[model samples]
Target: MKTSRLVIGILSIVLAVIVLFQSCAVGIGNALQANEEVSGSAGLMVAVILLVAGIIGIVTRNGGKGPFVAGAFYALGGILGLTNAGSYGDLILWSVVCFLFAAVFIIGNLIKKKS
Candidate 1:
């Protein structure tokens, strides 16, 4: 359980970095050009959400509720990634990572109870 929380804490920082990087004009422009589509307003929103969540996760790292909140945030981030079909590979990757973390937390607790 503690190990899971540690991994989540680390992942939160990584997620934050990814969001911040995406906020760069070059990244946004490239994303737009790739699709030759609408601007990156929607992506920006998701990035902001991820940033906020990551910050919260870091702040609440030692709290008992940290994992729960982090899990929710991760799931939301994964969903947001999935919404951008052009980034479907990233979407699947994030979703799997988030799910695996949640599963580890749950299973670890269950095993501890049985011991």
Candidate 2:
């Protein structure tokens, strides 16, 4: 398991948690307010998906191709986020970070394989 992959996995999980908490907060706030708009479900779904992917990456990190699989999931989530930009502009940043992490995992793995 490469250190970079491990670090990326941990960061991804952390980011997922942050997104989840924000989603929950928004949901609760909306529920408490009669006129409040509901706008957290999308964020929640994205966070959950990312969380699952991060966990998968961590669990399979020793399997050689696990990081790549995880990276793909992250990239996909990021792309999906683009469609929900109206409610969450942070999605762009999240997507960029995810892509960068994926790139690191892929390039690192390729180098390791070649060596």
Candidate 3:
């Protein structure tokens, strides 16, 4: 596996954990003050995508399509979250991060294909 994939995998997991904890801290306690945090469901969805992508990166062979598909999922999930953010304004940063990761993975995949 490429070093980029490995680094992305670890960082994705770390990001997932951060998202999860933030969601839980705000959601579970029903202490959402001014809608400055992501909703529980949305956070869970994003976190799951990140976690799955991380796992795929760590375990899959170099040429497998897991990272490519994970990239697609990251883009899809991020876009959906951004579009449906509603009153949850704090979700924007995480959504943007997802897009960044998606871009990295997709661009890396394309570069590999060309080589």
Candidate 4:
């Protein structure tokens, strides 16, 4: 269980980085093109939040709550992206990936608690 938490913590941090980079890329591209703001800022904010949560989870792996909290944030971000599909478009794919990762962590945490 400890090992699994460590692995999940690392992966969550990696995913957070990916999401943050992707959000920044999109925001920069929009700014360079002089396009009106869209969902980029929201996505960026969510990514930043996720990144922070991931770091916290990594730091508090033994606490058992960090991963679950981070996973909930991931799931919330994914759902937000999905619900705002008109603005997010292709980003929804990334959201789906987030959902999958969230499910893994949340379920793992739950099962660990049960055992």
Who wins the TM-score comparison? 3
Q: Write one digit per residue (lDDT tens) for candidate 4, span 1-115.
A: 5566567667766766776777777778778877675567756766775666566656766756777787787788787767654444656876786687678668877887888
**Residue-level lDDT tens digits of model 1 in 23-108:** 45534775756865322443454456555555655565555555466657666755665565253234345445555655554455
| lDDT winner | 3
Error of 3 at 90 (Å): 3.5
Task: Quantify all predictions' global Cα lDDT against the true fold.
Answer: 0.55, 0.71, 0.74, 0.69
Between candidates 1 and 3, the TM-score winner: 3
lDDT of 3 by residue, 22-108 (tens): 666646644446554446667767778878877776665275687788788789768866875644555677789888888888888
Q: Could you tell me how far off, in angstroms, the CA of residue 53 lies in candidate 3 after the best superposition?
A: 1.2
What stretches of model 2 exceed 4 Å from their correct place? 25-39
**Cα error, candidate 2, residue 13 (Å):** 1.3
- Tens-place lDDT per residue, model 2, 59-84, is 77665887678878877776666555
Collision count of model 2: 0
How many steric clashes between backbone atoms does each model show? 0, 0, 0, 0
Off by over 4 Å in 1: 23-27, 30-50, 55-63, 87-91, 105-115
Tell me, what's the RMSD of every candidate? 4.1, 3.2, 3.0, 2.7
Better of 1 and 3 by lDDT: 3
Q: Which is the winner by TM-score between candidate 1 and candidate 2?
A: 2
Estimate the TM-score of every prediction: 0.56, 0.75, 0.80, 0.71
Ranking of predictions according to lDDT = 3, 2, 4, 1
